[model samples]
Target chain A: MVKVVRNVVCPFCGTLCDDLEILVEDNHIVGTRHACRIGNAKFMHFEGAVRYTEPLMRENKKDDFKKVDYETAIEETARLLTEAALPLIYGWSATECHAHMYGVELAELVGAVIDNTASV
Target chain B: MQDVGYPVCTLGEVKNRADVVIYWGSNPMHAHPRHMSRYSVFARGFFRERGREDRTLIVVDPRETDSAKLADIHLQVEPHKDYELISAMRAVLKGFELQTDKVAGVPADLIYEAVEICKNAQFGQLYFAMGVTMTRGKHRNIDNAISLVIDLNAYTKFGLMPMRGHYNVNGFNQVLTWVTGYPFGVDFSRGYPRYNPGETTANDLLQRGETDMMLNIASDPGAHFPQKAVQHMAKIPLVCIDPHETPTTQLANIIIPPAIAGVEVEGTAYRMDGVPIQLRKVIDPPEGVLPDREILKMLIKKVKEML
Candidate 1:
């Protein structure tokens, strides 16, 4: 049976229409009502699309990314930043404020340049 | 521009009171599909009881976009000449006559008529987007438009807003301003937050090859950034944190997938009018997947320990 969730906020564009009705069946979104075309596509297709489910790592740019555990990925990322003289933390537009808080803290600790899409 | 702030209002106020709506260089029909029906043009409100019939819709663009099709008046201005058009509008509003027959491919008489409509409005709104911001004059176009709105206010109520693109783009600016004392392109290289747009901004840093590493979250710079910037990013040890695979992910040295915000994770996102709306979580993310905050927290802890 499909379950209907009303007043669901769309995460696609800045409009952030919050009156959408989402239809979910078997834990997957099946459809959306009162949503724009872009929002509808985002809701109906996100689950079935090719998504990165696990953390991945690659030693070199030419190498294929190998699946790694969260611990290893985080550790390696930290190591890369610690070893670098300067690093950049970019792209905070699509996420929420809590994540931005942590991102700011990480940039401070790493002494990195942090920016968002607004710069572009 | 921040120092000389312009008159503005919430989308709610616009929906209720706006009798004259001007879309300058923005095509809401394509970029923001529901913007017209929900707030600006068609929405029926307390004062705007008859919806579309009660409001005047005006669109200014170089081309006849879908949004322009619905406008009561479409000022098909010349490309990259928004600055001149705005200047002409301001001049006409100030009761000055133009010697030229046309300005920015728009007739001077039409501009006079448009200014008259704005001057007579009970409540008027002007919205601009990437077309104004990314054009040749860039910020100056916005500045001129704001000044025009200010001039209009001498006769009537007027407000202006930028048609922000990303869902939380405005939210990011709001949060960063409250925390760091500035918005975007912040550098912490000296143990203090410093903001210098052209120098510390991501594209400049990447283009100059000044930064040795990058931690990209949520946005896809690979697809959106210039070739030089993307090439520099491809050369660096880049870490990307996002829910889906993008061009940025393809070039990333490390990819960490997080739960999609506003879907699998609930958080506060500011609307285009600086109104904070709580995003709802209607479903669970894939097993073991976390939100951006969680991943960033773990990364922060790890980096702290390593340093």
Candidate 2:
């Protein structure tokens, strides 16, 4: 059986069209209506496409990226930033304001510079 | 975007009151597919009877876009000649006669007809897009358009608005303004908010090869920035934080995928017209995954501990 959800805000684009309906079956969106072509594809057809599901790490550029546990990846990233003389943080178009504020805090602690896609 | 301020109207207000609508360098059918059906021509409003028929539509662009086909008056402009066309229209509005046979490939008579509609309308709206702002004259083109609308106000009610692209560009501008006293390109390295566009803007810094390491938030600059900027970004160590995979991630040394906002997670976002709406989340994120704010908080904790 399919569960119908009405007024699903489109997760795609800036229109924020709040009248779309979605059909969820087995935890996957199988259908959508009242959404534009762009929104429909984003809501209903994202899976089956390639999605990176786990953290990946490469040992200093010579080796291919290997799937690492999230803890290992986060700690490794933190250590790199803590040790680096200069670090920069960029790209934040999808995150919310609270996240950006948190990002600012993190940047301050790491002594890194932060920028977003808007500048580009 | 300019030094001068112009009258602004919402899509709902325009639908309710406007009888004359002008689209400058914008195609809703291609760029904003649902704009017509939701707000402009197709929607039934308080005053708009027979939907699209109640409005006199004008489309001015170098190309005949899908949206132009619906216009009562369509002017196919000469590429990079928007300034001349707009200036000619403003002159005609101010009672000056055009001496040239044609200005910007548009006949003077058509300009007269557009002016006539503007002068006669009860309510008029002129909407512009990136085509005017990103072109040769840039700010000058917008200045002319705003002045044209201001002149129209003497004859009838008029307002001008940019058909802002992206769902939250205007919202971001509003938030940034509220937080930092500036809209974008804010630098805080001195522990103070300092805004300098050419020096601090992402592409400018990248082009100058000044950015050493980049913490890319939710945006994908690699796909959109100019080639020179992208070349420099490719040389730097980069981090990507997004819900989905993009070309930027392909070039990223670190990719931190967060739960999709407005979908897997909920937040407040402002509309194109500066109206705020709270997004409703239907389902939780995949187990072990978290909202972007939470992830950022985790990073903050980790960084502080490192300190």
TM-score of chain A of each: 0.94, 0.85
Q: Candidate 2: where are CA atoms >4 Å away?
A: A59-63, A69-91, A101-120
- DockQ, candidate 1, comes to 0.85
Q: What is the C-alpha lDDT of each candidate?
A: 0.90, 0.74
Tell how far residue B296 is off in model 2, in angstroms.
Answer: 1.8
iRMSD, all candidates: 0.9, 2.5
lDDT of 2 at A40: 79
Off by over 4 Å in 1: A46-48
- Per-model TM-score, in order, reads 0.97, 0.89
DockQ of each: 0.85, 0.48
True contacts kept of each: 0.85, 0.41
How well is each residue in B227-252 modelled by candidate 1, as lDDT tens digits?
Answer: 99999999989999987888899898
